[model samples]
Target chain A: MPPAASPVPCKPLFFDLALNHIGFPSLDHKLPVKGAEAASPASAGEANKPDQPGGLSGLVKGLWGWGSKK
Target chain B: MAHNIKNVRIQAAYAELKKLIDQGSYSRIIKTTNKIVNDDQSQPEAWQCKVVAYIQLDQFKEAINAINKAPNRQQMQFELAYSQYRLNKVAAAIDTLDSAPDKDSPRGKELRAQILYRLEQHSECYTVYRELLRTTADDMDMERTTNMAAVQVHRVELGQCPVPS
Candidate 1:
């Protein structure tokens, strides 16, 4: 039987390289909780008052919020 | 905290894949995204990235496989149609969109418009493009304009439109 070709090495996924995409800068950082800021109209004085949802749910919720009126 | 890290990791991985795609490093993208898929096959974005990488590599069969791995097949229909289109399976691409229940979906309609244009169905293609321009996002402006112009030229050549009397 013929020998198979050597498998190519997997390049390490890098953050800076990944951040080259236009959308990634926001994705790399904290995403504000949807509607949290709007729900508290009086919190204009506070610098960071959001009760943010973190991680996948937050991202999904953010995208869902963009897609639908809520 | 755990969920936050997880999402960030996934997003970073996805972003890396997108970057590699933009760099035209399809093989590297496939290798890396396959690792992500192996860790968690449920990530739709990962599967989508893989599908696009495979398409860029002209690996249509693998692109189809990657899309099939996605949880929501309906959501990935546009990508599937695109892979089929690249494979010169235009009718199959049209059928893929047609079979989806959301006939009015912007993605389906836009892709169908492109396919219709490819099939030289200029009138129907133009109507689809116009509807898309009215209904879709601003990002679609370039595509809609290009398709509409192509339709106009095709119509003029066929004597379907008056050349301004």
Candidate 2:
């Protein structure tokens, strides 16, 4: 009698580490409003003050003034 | 609003699916993805997740079916070919790959090389592996090098020169 044929061993195939490669979609979420931090009480008070500029300009002015004083 | 509620439901479903995937829960992923797709048949991500889960479970036919229903089938050509390859439909896999827009991608090339190796086209397989090695980073060279060595071994077994001239 003839012997039964055995199955061949298949080599391992390399796959991407992440599901993103398989077309899995990312979570869709809304971005926070820009300058939302300015709404904080401390920052709002600082912004409302007559002399202080708001946000980036305020930070830059503070830095420049500090440098000039030195 | 109704729109907000729907968005929240979809978000929660996706979050659960992500958690299931991280846990390697293939069955749960299939169940969850099925529910998601039932609620919204146009959810390409749900179809994609179901296909991947089916493949992981060695259910290639089911994977292929899920892929057929996906809205973004064109973008999932590699995955379709992969499932076909797992099913031992090598020629079909190759045909599917030939139609892929990103056939030149590293993953696509790697899969093509594997199918060529299975078909015993060693020289073609070697050329693909060489191309991959040339582009692969040093840290990721181990697997490609191993595959290249296997090709050389097969060549030697066939009484040909181990290394290509």
Candidate 3:
């Protein structure tokens, strides 16, 4: 099977918080790459999340502190 | 909207504590710090959240409910005994340890002795600490094992009386 074409190129952004010390534990514990991967859309059905309050949007918003889009 | 009390800011601490404890990170001990602050966060799961928060901060209470919520047997017994000790209740701590399902586990024995020491039951602590030293069993954490053994010696020696000059 042919692979799907990329819609957009990805890039990583880095922030330098030179003065922060607690950032170490905060980053290590909170940025959950594990849960994010498990919750990928391609593998999970859409309907499954409806029962979960605001659903996936709520989860993502909660995980990364992403506020509701304007 | 009656968004109620399920705000992310409210639960963020709990979510953090759960992850930290699961990974054995940093031992965020908080069981006995702010009793009044906790008695005031009126919300669902408030007590559980308070107990967990306090456990992370090392401000442990009697931990009756906290013990029930412990994710595993060892942690549950440890918290239960520790809470009892904080309340100046030693017999209850011993009872809790005696009833633990895995009494033979070194951590379990360590916990029981720690409780005795907290109760100022130094002789018992000395005896149990000696017993733990003899186990010499293998586990993934050799460093932690050695440290716990050393803690027993440190406590016993510290508890000893000074001779009159």
Candidate 4:
């Protein structure tokens, strides 16, 4: 017999802003098609890191128009 | 009759708005629909079109307000939930979708499952997708497979299921 199904959690999981209507995660970055070769590696590396802002300072930075640093 | 003429005019305006939307003219969609609504607020289709334009322009608050005032709120509940979901109003989105008139609508179910996944309600989300597999037989294999994987991961995370040996 198949394994018993797991129970539903009382609360929901963390949210993902990049998910589309179909339950698939959308690629947040623009694809490198036309100007990919011209792109710098530094920016590409930054794209891979998660978007967690650490604390109050990070939240302030986010609110005050500070972007991700190199 | 004057009413028939007004209906024809509204249809023409809506057709023009639809063309603008297809051309990706979201701003013009708003402008044109604004005129249409000013003339006829009873046209629910115009309200719906304006809501769609606002969403495309990333104006979630405006979209939410528009949906709230829509005459056919039940018909447009999915769009309302979608805007709420985009705004990170997860619980509200779920609630809105729960009240959708078409309870078994595949699109509504699919979006609800996605929101459930975001909330980490993986087991419940997976169950929804599984039910959808039977109701929706087209272009859903990837959705099902990914949701299954998500549920398995969630189960392991919760220690309800062991990791593969």
Candidate 5:
């Protein structure tokens, strides 16, 4: 009986080599976390804020606040 | 941290394998693929598809393995291509992607994106999602937009639901 060829070495999984297709830099380090930074409005500042979800009470406060500003 | 370290080790090894292949140490790829084939259960749709991909430059070998290890006759090419893509066989992936059937194209990208996403490669998924939106979408822009928004809300990676605007 012929000897089976030594099962070749297990190759690496090469995770980020696939990312080369998408043009992300640093294949070995640093993936951008989605929405982590943009989730908080305070750091990004008030003028840049998109509408936030507020209950009816907050809406009343907002209206009053708007009147006070004028 | 052990599992994370192990994962990093595996990734590094694969990168080395890819580097060897790129450096014209091509014979190692065959040996490497053989190893993967043996360590694995030869289960269809498992990572065995990747082994088949490295043989693309050799049509007969690639075709044979692809036919044998493929999940199905239909999905074989894309599966193989996805594997090669992982191994940094970029040209091979593009070739496989191109030769595959039109119906298979979306499936191919989805599978590739899926593999990447599982590895925590969300950026690639985002790229593929944008490309898929091109072919899968139609004149109904508003509807597609609404549907995708809902899909994002659902956070289901594989679902291709079209939301109503």
Candidate 6:
């Protein structure tokens, strides 16, 4: 008579090597335009400061202050 | 300037693909990789990503097809063998692994040991596991030890001594 099959459930250690091998360009570096845009808002905010005593900057600050009061 | 724009577009596409992979969005990976490969058939990484996505989806046949489309079959032998193993094409899987350049790699040995176990070649499996345990560090030796123990149990069940030593 043939022996009974072993009950131990031995299975293959399946894994994908492609996950490690498939290389893609790193996304760590921001695009030049994106970097410029990120800096724009901070500069624009500084320029719109109410303490600035001059032309377009002061005019924009006055409008912003007036709008905030309403 | 044109070349730089094209490079940026390629980088953006890869970034999106990486995000999709991290999220386990296999379907989206397939779609995105398909587009990338269509634009450049020479992109082996795109083919690999598509194959991996198909495997994750349990579509072994599709995975095999994608592997076949890869620019370099030698580099994808492990993937081809793995998909074959999953599909229950055991003999073919062994053949594929045998043809691989790095067939002696740890991963390749592990897969081969598993295949041997499936084929009821317990002694051969035990030898493979033993070699793996010898070469690998203690921390990574757990799986090899467990597999070797299982193989030993089978050997004893077959009325053979667990180990000659």
Index of the highest-DockQ prediction: 2
Cα lDDT of model 6 by residue, B1-165, tens digit:
976776677666777787887798999989988877766688766777788788788898998988887886678888788888778898998999999887898878878887787778988988888887888675546656766777787888787774455
DockQ for all models: 0.02, 0.11, 0.02, 0.02, 0.02, 0.06
Q: Provide the lDDT at A44 for model 3.
A: 68
Candidate 5 structure quality by residue, lDDT tens digits, B89-143: 6566667666767424556665555454444444555566567678765444354
TM for candidate 4 is 0.63
Residue B26 displacement in candidate 2 (angstroms)? 1.6
Output the better candidate (2/6) by TM-score.
2
Candidate 5 clashes: the total is 2
How many pairs of residues collide in each model? 0, 0, 18, 3, 2, 0
lDDT per model, in order? 0.66, 0.77, 0.50, 0.70, 0.48, 0.74
lDDT per residue for candidate 1 within B37-154, as digits (tens), equals 7767786656666666676667888889877867856666766777787677989988887776655666667667778877889899889888878886665477467658767777
Please give, for residues A27-63, the per-residue lDDT of candidate 6 as tens digits: 3452344456557988778657655566986788779
iRMS values in order, in angstroms? 14.0, 5.1, 16.8, 10.9, 15.0, 5.7
lDDT of 2 by residue, B89-129 (tens): 99998999999998998778888888887778888988999
Clashing pairs in 4: A12-B119, A13-B119, A13-B120
Judged by DockQ cut-offs, is candidate 2 incorrect, acceptable, medium or high?
incorrect
Give candidate 5 misplaced runs (Cα > 4 Å): A1-70, B1-13, B42-55, B70-74, B78-165
lDDT of 3 by residue, A1-70 (tens): 9999878623222111111111112323332543675588854666475556777678776767645442
Compare candidates 1 and 5 on lDDT and give the better one. 1
By lDDT, who's the top model here? Answer: 2
Runs of candidate 6 with Cα error greater than 4 angstroms are A1-70, B1-8, B138-140, B162-165
Task: Give the per-residue lDDT of model 4 (tens digit) for B32-83.
Answer: 7787777788877677778877877889899888878877667777778888
Off by over 4 Å in 4: A1-70, B1-11
Error of 2 at B17 (Å): 1.3
Per-model RMSD to reference: 16.8, 10.6, 20.1, 16.7, 22.6, 10.7
Which stretches of candidate 1 lie above 4 Å from their native place?
A: A1-70, B1-25, B101-103, B136-143
- Could you tell me the TM-score of chain B in model 6? 0.88
**lDDT tens digits, residue span A1-70, model 1:** 9899898634222111101111111222322333365467566534353465458887887789888975
